[model samples]
Target chain A: MNVAKHMLFPDVGEGIREGTLVKWLVKEGDPVKEDQPIAEVETDKAVVEIPSRDHGTVLKLYGKPGDVILVGKPLMTVGEPGEPMPDAEEAITESNEKKVEVPKKEASAAPERILAPPSVRAAARKAGIDLSKVSGSGPGGRITAEDLEKAKGGALAAPASTHQEKTLSFDYGKGKRVPLTHLRKTISERMSWSWRHVAHVTYIEEVDFGALKELRGRNKPKAEQMGFKLTPLAYMVKAVATTLKQYPRFNASLDEEKAELILHDEINVAVGVDTEEGLIAPVLKNADQKSVFDIAKEIGGLSEKARARKLSLDELRASTFTVTNIGSVGGVLATAVLNPPESAILGVNRMKDRPVVRDGKIVIRPMTYLGLTFDHRVGDGADAARFMKDLVEKLENPAWMEKG
Target chain B: MSRKKVFEAQIEYLQILDEKGNVDASLDPKLDELTLKKMYETMVRSRAMDKKAISLQRQGRCYTYVPTEGQEAAQVGSVMASKKEDWMVPAFRENAAYLAKGVSMRTLFLYWMGHEEGSRFEKDQNCFPVSIPVGSQVGHAVGLAWAAKIQGKRQAAITFFGDGASSEGDFHESANFAGVFQIPCVFICQNNQYAISTPRARQTRSETIAQKAIAYGFEGIQVDGNDVLAMYVATKKALEKGYAGKGPTLIEAITYRIAAHTTSDDPKRYRDEAEVEAWRKKDPIARFQTYLKKNGFWNEAYEKEVQEKAAREVEEAVKKAEGFQANPEDMFKYLYQDLTPDLRQQMQEMKQSLEG
Candidate 1:
């Protein structure tokens, strides 16, 4: 008997739940070869072509190019027409959610043997727990959590079964184990991937505020007259932009397979803004060239738009660099990990005028603290230090634009 | 311990200056001469900064400035009680508290200048940022201080807000957290006579804002915000006790907002000249200056030099601030650490639109 086949789902990059059929490479009734391009599907991140598994005549087309097909599900069926298809139950696995019955138990029963994945066997053995004796709570009495618990303590032997149920309880209980969507799953994998791939080094430093205070002062009135509310955020943007120019490499991220640093030429700075929906980063492209006034106007507009949840998907994607200032409500310095694909992020803290030894005199200066977290793959301790120092220098000098 | 502690916690109120501007023997021992002198300086400096900020606003140099001109003693006294590592969370009106905490005049000026970059404070300074949104900072303080407790930093945080903040949900949230965790936090409510134009009686039915601390399972006290020494003593005690793991403290520092709500608001519209004159009589800086003169601690020469030096410092700060490139883009710059996909597209579209 020959095995029949249907196209199983493919792993499409980006946070796409379902893929849209852009075009079909094969037509219905077309004789398809194994590993052939079946169709192109468009996802949130990119468009990718689906591949067929086995050579067969296309018996049926379940969907068209315009339709979206979920991964791990059947897209089309193919089988030989010369012979009635053998019970190739494996072919319809993507669609089958019920028991595949091998129906009659033999009259002469061989001792019930566990037919399961090897990993489950190993897991049971590791616990010094046997799956042989206990009745499996799985479909068709498959060995599962309940079976494992029964094996742990024979019903006649121990009273520990109640509390011991945690180890043996494999059922979804009365609850459900729903599958994760593409976006949420992507978020999980990325967060974990960052933890695994990047060596997050957080270095915090305190800055004196005397200059910041003076700089803010001389500009506030004029800014207001200019119809912009001069805010500490604008000043921070200035400092970060100046710092980025000095240490351009901090703006670069690593290309995993190429094992090379992709240093972006343009500086597209992203600011994490809190909106009604969630936290979204609205980028300011070419920030280096933009004047503070332009920046302020853009900020006011973007924040309003962000708060209104009117930002398009594109506005959230274009950041080569980013800054999250949690200091709005006066937070002390906070450590943050690298936002994937970006080499570093600067965490801005609340401003406080604390006592400092300025020019060998104990004077009260307004101070801000910052914590920078960068990817070790693209940076070293020295690189981070240099970057931080540059940022600090910019903040310390409000007249930086004058010198520039 | 519970009842007595509760009563003692309520004893932090301060208002009148001592005969010579020194605390009573029982109270003076709580603050030494140096501490007292430092308190006086901070109050005066905060006043000077506020005055400068107001003038800067008038000169069409900076944005709207919140002047803590009449409430200096209240902010300075209570906030200076914090340990360097302890956090001071401030509402927008806590200008004097900001100065007392040591935020530089230049940075404060930058903030008033409406530069977001100016809001970026130094990294190691354990303080929450100045939030323009009223009543939001208190909750942040509770959360931050709770984090400190979890990490065993043993450093508490004190949040500053005006009586207006009492109406915000953050106040209740922070107060609840501080009490529940027994976290070292002090919610310093500067009960300046008004919230913009809303009078105290119209604000809440609670007899005293400090008494509200009892509902949250911590100590609460009413402090005379005008009395610099009392403010200092009470704040110091709260910090010490909080750090010692006693619990959080809610302090209602009763003071007056002699200055306008900001450079934009006209106090004359809501508040009468009689009210202003009455409050002017209790000027925080002048009262302390008078008390300092009465005692041997300060004289006419020291006062003259201090005032002159302060004015010069303010003037120089203004000059430096004005000289700095008024790069306005600092506003849109620092938002998120990294941009999401959509932001890039919008930025591109915006650039093209602007350029085209």
Candidate 2:
């Protein structure tokens, strides 16, 4: 039988919803084996080679290089040798029920789609409010959770009503509208999934980083000689890794279907890096098995790769634990969302001079807040609290980092 | 009114095999060489399967598993003591008991993988699926035993749980009911010290878990859970007593959870490495293997062959489990023989969502 099989673009990495066709490894009429690399597609993480799942001849190619393809959209077609080719328009009409077309004018009117996170969208939906009617106040005019709350409280009642009444008369060319990038779309889906699925309980603790600062100061020259800037994040990763060795639940993932917690033996710490495109976390594999210097070096290299968009799928995935340094990005404190499947994520905040009573004497010390968001379904609150206490103690005395 | 001494319970402790692989002749379970060798090999095979499960979980091929590293003797010996026709109820960590009862390893793997088919077994197998809720299996075992009693069947039911389950109210209720009815049921409590991260000390204030059975008007005995011979002797005696219509018996096996509570747990959180090392020296499989070699029933070559055979069996089981197709809609099928209106709607909705 000369049946044709349409191959869609598979998810190349975790949470990747779309990819750009970088190059077609097989041309039309080329015979290909099952599992052969048929095309190279550029996902948000890296360039991945999409393989053929059927052994046959490539009957038709759907997209050209540099064209964007949605996941589950046909990338190519494989059929028996010399089969009658289906007309492109006929193929399009047959799959038209699945295709969605957004008119240009309608796309510009919904500018809020480019900014708000999933939680905000969900809250807006539940409140029966149109997201386009609510004005965003966050960075890049992104809608915050508070914005949704205010909208629910009728704060935007006037504008919303005005928008409804002016629906027919409103001008479409009043403001510029930008399309959501693949990275932004991916982040939206992933963050929404994480927020919805994980039972997040965030615990925040403050640590005196005086000794750590002094240690970093002493090691700065040696680190400079080694060709990498020494940062507190490196020390934080080390402390988290060490603490996880003691409290393994934090270094675990929850499989809800199986009702099991998957505790990982190796500590792979992911550091969230902000780049020009968006936020990307690159993993530092086997952090527990590495020394502070080695961790710092890998952190430097991985961060560079992240910013340059050169991180491989391997580097961008497989994180048993995550540490986001909001401190470097100038935040005093923030509760992070649990990375999906991972039981916990640690957020490091900015360090500032603070006065505190130690040994009945008031002294100014460098202190920073460590916010740990954990999946309560996998562990108890007491477990998270104890883990935080141990982490604080380890960060307070980073002399352990110098031992190895 | 003058106060009078009402009740006193004397708990007997059994230890046939010591840490040094020395078996007390008086307490020895005098089985033939073939059965002795089989018991030792089963323990080794269980250990091999446990290691394989751990590695497979790490590789993302399986879901989280509770390794039965230090409790093999408690599992294998008790299951071996039960007759083939007797009912066996198991908690989540009773891999040794499952393998010993001739349940295919693939069924176990499929169960852990979250497939409903994994719970399906032949009618005559008489082995229940793994129970996740702590101590709930006790009631089921008691009910099964009571049903057998009512039917005039000679089969006894053996239920396996942990020390953690001893704290649950179900255990108390089941024990009370079993005692009142004088049913043929054996409650095997493998006290592996910690329930997840909580220590056994926190699980209960009582010094001995077996003593709890005395309050229900039944005999309670403690045994060295690391000693296979002791476990066999104690369980055998309890099963015999049950079959003789003497009521139920709670056998508390003193053992340590050498591995984490599960793949998702870290024993180091609430336990000391030195304590784990101390327990390592008293490993049930190691002790049993040493006893086997000392009795001329095993040698290095035979041990190697046993491990190889176990590995091959586990590998084949993994392949079979991986090959099995999982149907999501099958979850609703076994819930009711005739699906209710609500359940039928749910099944339809699930099918729509999956198809979408």
Candidate 3:
């Protein structure tokens, strides 16, 4: 008796949904060795060659080149060559398919389309009503803001008032319509999703970059010899990664359904690189284990690859935290959106010459703003502020950079 | 006593049709009128599709797309020479090659739209997905050919790359492997003069990219890439040699990148317009059209009909591509054969957030 095993496209990257079958190294009916590359699949960020785990004949291949295989869908079947395969119905109801069906709740039916103005729609959304159920009494059977208010009042058993809010409409001139690129679309969706799910609280602190500037100046030559230019951002990455060990919440992601915080063991810092396409955050993996100079070198290489659209899927995924240097673009401060699955993001602003009180005397110092935007679901405002305070203290003094 | 020279590589350049559209009858491959016309039509269709993709990019309907405007002959001609069963390993800029290989226009559009389904091909197709990491596909082609050789298969593998790719270590390694194994493979390099802002001259100090094949112990040749007849004849000869077990050969098709490196690049940043205008006079499609007209294979009515058909096909593909409901979670799927512990955790988190 021969038992056929179904192979599904694995979840290779963080939240990846599909992959394109680039090539099948083995043909159907061919005998394959274990650990042989059976197929190559191109995901969003990389072309991954999948290896066979078991030694078996290629019983059946599901997709051809250029066909997108969904995750959890059968990619191939491995069994004895020329063996009679199971029927389709049996395959469909297999254990792997059952796992895919387990989490799928019956989708709530979409609300019916209602013809309403912007203000009325806003009112309906604010009141949390199924707009399709509401009847309109305005012109041409249109739902007005008054109608939404009355519907809300009736639902709550409250008295309806005669007060009407004025709705404003403006004419905007036509301009060129630009379609969003894939990166832009992803950015837009992710940002909005972050805003909707994560309660964001940003804490800003001013840090003196005087000590950092001196350290960078002293180490610039040594860094150059090691094939990397020392920058303030590298030092900040080190400081943030070190401080994360003390405040684990900032380095964690919240699984709201399970109400669990995932504290990552390795410090994977994502650095934002601006490209002609859009902003991409490439990860500097295992940053906690790397020295400041090593981080600097990796940053240089990763940024170049990111800008060239050459980053691999591994570089694009599994970022435990993010650091964006608005200072490179000359911004004083910016509150960055939390890259979800990661609870917090650090934004470093430009250092400017400012008057500072040194021993009761006014002195010029290079001061910069550091903004920490965190998911309030994971931590409180006080905790977020403390993380920033620790980061600032480490930056203001150069001892941490030397010690670690 | 003086030592005699052991070997010298002679680089032969093939040009059946000149820039003036004048064909050398003696050098012509003597293809049937119908096949020649089909080749011409395919080039036009490829150009039409490219134009549509660029317009789509400008309209924000597609992602960053690389246009194959001026080098249609090199792509179409080389692909036309291969048998249907032969393998084709292409770089990201091989729109014409894909078209010639019977890849649907909708699939191309879907790919530019960032859909994974676009890259998936049917079981019969021997073409690989567009390799984005420059010259990396060369090694895959070599390995594929080696596999065929070991399996006693008669099929040959043709790999496409650029002058910029020839500078990569992967290309040299693949060339060396192909030479050592004596596998049936053809390396076609479209020397399109520029890799982004870097010129071909800066890519290599060698007088000709074709000469680089000599060090790997293989024959290499050059051809006027804009001349379809020359490209076709050279590729046919190379494929024949591969089938005859004469090992791999590299063909350097001298061409120009008429468009920017990609939609995201600005050619004006580094290149001069006058230079572009000069290349326009030697456009592959225009020159091919002239040849077809001389052969009585093309007329005003036929040209118009072909263009209309191409436009209609491209529009239909655009529609089909737009019909896809791209799921964001699709990115996380098919990343591996099985989810690792970390990936499983990430998926659970993603599912929860999406649910909320």
Q: What C-alpha lDDT do the candidate models reach, one value each? A: 0.72, 0.83, 0.83
CA RMSD of each candidate after superposition: 33.9, 14.5, 23.1
Instruction: Give me the displacement of residue B260 in model 1, in angstroms.
Output: 0.7
Residue A2 CA error for candidate 1 (Å)? 97
Worst 10 residues of 1 chain A by lDDT: A98-107
Predicted candidate 2 versus true structure: per-residue lDDT over A1-404, tens digit per residue: 56587765654443355677767999998998755778877765355566676788998888776567776567888889777666555555555653445545556776535578988888778878888887888855888987777776575466555544232566678685655556677788989999878889888889999998888989988989989888878888988898899888888888888888899978998899998778899899999888888888899999898876667566777899999988785867789987676889998889999999999999999989888899888888899889989988888877877742
lDDT of the structure predicted as candidate 3: 0.83
- Backbone clashes in model 2, listed as residue pairs: A263-B264
**Higher lDDT: candidate 2 or 3?**
3
TM-score of each prediction: 0.45, 0.54, 0.48
Q: Interface RMSD for candidate number 2?
A: 12.0
Using Cα atoms, each model's DockQ against the true complex is 0.00, 0.02, 0.01
Query: What ranking of all candidate models by lDDT puts the best one first?
Result: 3, 2, 1
Local lDDT at B309 for model 3: 95
Which sequence of candidate numbers ranks them by TM-score, best first?
2, 3, 1
Docking class of 3: incorrect
Lowest-sum lDDT 10-residue window in model 1 chain B: B1-10
**Residues B156-224 of candidate 2: C-alpha lDDT, one tens digit per residue:** 999999988999999999999999999899999999998887888899888799999999999999999
